[model samples]
Target: MDRLPRLACSDPRLTRLIAIYETLAPATLGALEALFAPQARFVDPFNDVSGPAAIRRVFEHMFETVDAPRFEVLDAAIGAGGGAFLLWNFHFQSRDKQRTPRCIQGTSHLRFDEQGRVLLHQDHWDPARQLYEGVPLLGGLLRRLREHLAAR
Candidate 1:
């Protein structure tokens, strides 16, 4: 689990961003045009993209690859200068029927423009625990490696 700096949630801008993310879906990706600036940047463990279309594409891809993908915003903080941090869990079921629904806990750091549209979004999470550890052969190998490293 990565620790993130705490932020206040009193800012309405931050509140709106949280709401948008909590209710986000591929069909409602159009809502991003209102939540994010045209040139807003988004980055995560797997993606580094800018602009609303590119960002929407990321979410679209998630929908295409997963089942019932959703976000649950757990907490948030608002900075004095339009910066915010959100702690959330991304819940989804794997495309493969054998796999069950899982939750990936992560934190989003966002910078909003003066008008309250997101200007930048960065995410931090542990891929080993959230993703790779659930894989088949790779899961065992990664778990062993983690144990080996932790013991040293």
Candidate 2:
């Protein structure tokens, strides 16, 4: 369990959205429409999509690829103009039994419609280091490349 940061100004919509994310599951994906507008745009390292249906597909693929995928909201804040930001960690295990569990720290910027449903959702995270760098062979190559590219 993660501790939620105290919000300076509590927005019910943001609160509810966080709850949805923290408890999100395959069965509960249908609830996305309640949090996202019909034409909401969602973008991440590997996906750029519009509309709730497409967003749902992205999440569905996550479920298909990983075991017990979940999100822990570490911190959140509501902007003065109905926008919001969420800092979170995505936890999951690879379907491959040999791979250990993994966590990806990320942040999301969200803009809401007048109705409090999200219009835009953009995720910020580094997949090269957080994801690809964990592969056996590629990981070693990437690590060596990072070392060579290091400033100091």
Candidate 3:
């Protein structure tokens, strides 16, 4: 697999945020309050919520559902007007005895507040291809549907 080139970033807040993501764990969930604004909004394919508490719950649920879930920041860039983008790969294992490992590639768009805390964080990724396509029965069905829908 080709690796993405990591971009150099000078912004301290963006650097800190990236570090937080790369090192995230159940013990570090408390750090969200410092990284996000009181009313920050977080949106992903599965959850859409506002505030640090709600965002914490989202991560909490992830921890409960998966084993050893972690994020690998492949590349990051700061955008104009206090915005930033992060390309990341999420790695985890299923909770079952087999513990099948999975990886999901995604990107996050972040807008920072004046205080350098995240005001909005939106994640973009394809659930059908990255997630559901790996399931047993569902995976086969989705692959068949995808083949059927493709241009011949």
Instruction: State which candidate has the highest lDDT.
Output: 3
- Per-candidate TM-scores read 0.88, 0.91, 0.92
RMSD versus native structure for model 1: 3.6
Ten contiguous residues with the weakest lDDT in model 1: 1-10
User: For model 2, which pairs clash?
Assistant: none
The TM-score obtained by model 2 is 0.91
The candidate with the higher lDDT, 2 or 3, is: 3
Rank candidates by lDDT, best first.
Answer: 3, 2, 1
Q: How close is candidate 1 to the true structure, as a TM-score?
A: 0.88
Candidate 3 lDDT, 67-142, residue by residue in tens: 9999988888888766899888999998777999888999999998888999999999999998888889999999
At residue 94, candidate 2 shows an lDDT of 84
Query: Candidate 2, after superposition: displacement of residue 65 in Å?
Result: 0.6
Using TM-score, give the best candidate's number. Answer: 3
Give the winner by TM-score: 1 or 3.
3
Instruction: Put down candidate 1 lDDT per residue, 84-140, tens digits, no spaces.
Output: 888888889887867688889989999988787889999999999779998899999
* lDDT score, candidate 2, position 2: 55
State the C-alpha lDDT per candidate: 0.83, 0.87, 0.89
Clashes of 2: 0
